[model samples]
Target: MDIKEYIVIAIAINAGKTILGIYNSDVDLKLDQSPLTLADRKSHYIIKNKISQTKLPILSKEGRKVSYQHRRIWSKYWLVDPLDGTKEFIKKNGEFTVNIALIENSKPVMGVVYSPVLDILYVGAEELSAFRIKQASELLKYLTLINDWRNYAESLPLLSTINIFRIVVSRSHLTKETLEFINSIRDQHSEIELISKGSSLKLCLIAEGYADIYPRFAPTMEWDTATGHAIINATEGKVCQADENNKESLLNPKFIAGAFNVDEKRINNHGR
Candidate 1:
């Protein structure tokens, strides 16, 4: 099996399953006021332990804080968010995901995202493009199923003739800037559909062609978007920084992500 299909995909699945195991644990607030749980720690350790076999440095949101000075020198590393959407997980909404990405030269070359509750997996790489698998939770213990899974997996940007202009936004984080962005989109497209999703699923919707665009004007860390960005790129889509000035920062600038064949004029005008 390919590394992305076997290692990255498996690691995400394992971490996601571990998270689901502790789904009902008590939730505490971090210094940033984000929810934290035993599941987050368990998933982080599980991914850290397994992915260490690759011998590449790891940058995980849940892991130790690696100084930018230390991280700047590494040409290649594994970027992980062991448990994304802590709020959604706490809400039992099943929109949380385990995100893993391979970064080289400051760009994501490969990625895997697994949603434990939904039992879906999305994987992508420069070489392999992108794919989405249903019932991916069942592949956790069965390595032999990799080939079968790949065969059955749906290629990303699945729809070729979508009519309505769909915009996906964070369920828990609808900011004033986001609303303004939506209103701007409404001015351009007569038929607009708004989708409320949690976590990286917003990006996944664009990758799978379920949504046309995802405008994230709220704050988000690099790890939160890295996996989804890679998948979208694999499908010939864009995850562009809203501000070109902050392109070098570790914290992602406000951004807009869109599916392949989306109106470039829309993105070019708004994703500045």
Candidate 2:
């Protein structure tokens, strides 16, 4: 990990601590019909404050919205979702995560997704390989061994075998389109198994090879998938949009992710 990656990880760990604090308390409702908590607000403040040291503009869910008119002028920026999966958080399912990514030229160059409940941190950067730090070690301990953290971490694509078509979908939320997409693939894979997970972990599962694909047919903001995209792309997996012709859009549509050679035929065929 470099200096930027180190800072992002530290911030995520700190933010995760804040989120856990709020998780133990009552949550409130947002105007957008989603759950909100002090953790969300506090995490946003903490990340924004820390990332400001890099002197990069941030496009966070809780911060001022930056339209493409202005956002396009920047060569780089910070994309963050202080706390993802508020619904899961409200349900206390321990599937929520805090996501942070460094975006350069519309692509996530560095990513970190931290789950406070699970005490798992997944990180990936441009020159650095993706790695996961689990409950066995303290996250900040890497601060002292930034260049050698890989020595204490587990590399990505955790599995080398692709046994069957395994899929990851939202446990608390699913869409008709997603179901249809799954059925479309069932023709090619009879032993397809479906796993339910919340937050950006779905993408992380695909990155580490615990699952093969996560198709998102419902709506999702840029921040929701940016970090996941980075981690997935760091390995052999990827997150893509519906428009095959336009690859620059950060907003997600119906998309599919899998290994490098995983047939994207289904997504291209089902493009809406």
Candidate 3:
């Protein structure tokens, strides 16, 4: 399907999440060991079915189990993380999001992140462009574009002589390796502040220049960060290799760095 059509589907599915998330408060809560809720299931179903119409095989967190044997053969496909922040959803923290990404040759080319509670949609493509759309008051009016959004981004001051950096960590899952990595940074940087956030919004904070770096040392599947990774890349930011020992093994499967003030060429090299 075309980009506009995909966006429409994303917004529609996000609206469904808003309805269900609100409704779920009155119903009995079923908390899985890993924070699964009815709203997550509902959103996942809506997005999965809607994207299925595009005729592309989907590898989704809530959909059918397709083996990598089949997935490895496809040139292009969809990667989805419907209801990304299930813990945040259950907590009513309003930080959860729905993520949809198009992966071409194991790299994300396009992505859409919709936060139902916030009524914000961030869309982008590696070849095309990126934009943030906010929902209008009139139900039929659709999304109103925010003009000169890049100007707002450029207005932010750059990092100069700061010895310490702000680091964003996962709220639900914290690992010892992640802590050790943070401590390692703390040894060099004077003061390290750890901010806890859920879902892809962590990447947004870095893209918006609120945070300096975000490192995920634990295991994370591709769909979990694809959309946010795309956004970080588009915003002239670098999600680079953290390993100091091996430069070639730059793209850390263990960690990701969202340095917003960095150059695009540097970030592009990280992608390689």
Highest TM-score: give the candidate number.
1
Q: For every model shown, what is its TM-score relative to the native structure? A: 0.90, 0.88, 0.75
Give the Cα lDDT of each candidate: 0.81, 0.78, 0.62
Cα RMSD (Å) per model?
Answer: 3.2, 3.4, 6.0
Model 3, C-alpha of 229: deviation from truth (Å)? 1.2
C-alpha lDDT of residue 71 in model 2: 76
The runs of at least 3 residues in candidate 3 whose Cα sits more than 4 Å from the true structure, single-residue gaps closed, are 1-24, 28-36, 136-140, 143-164, 241-252, 262-272
Runs in model 2 lying further than 4 Å from the true structure: 26-35, 141-143, 160-162, 242-250, 264-272
Ranking by TM-score: 1, 2, 3
Ranking by lDDT: 1, 2, 3
Cα lDDT tens digits, model 2, 187-240, are 877699999999999988988888877878788777888888888878856665
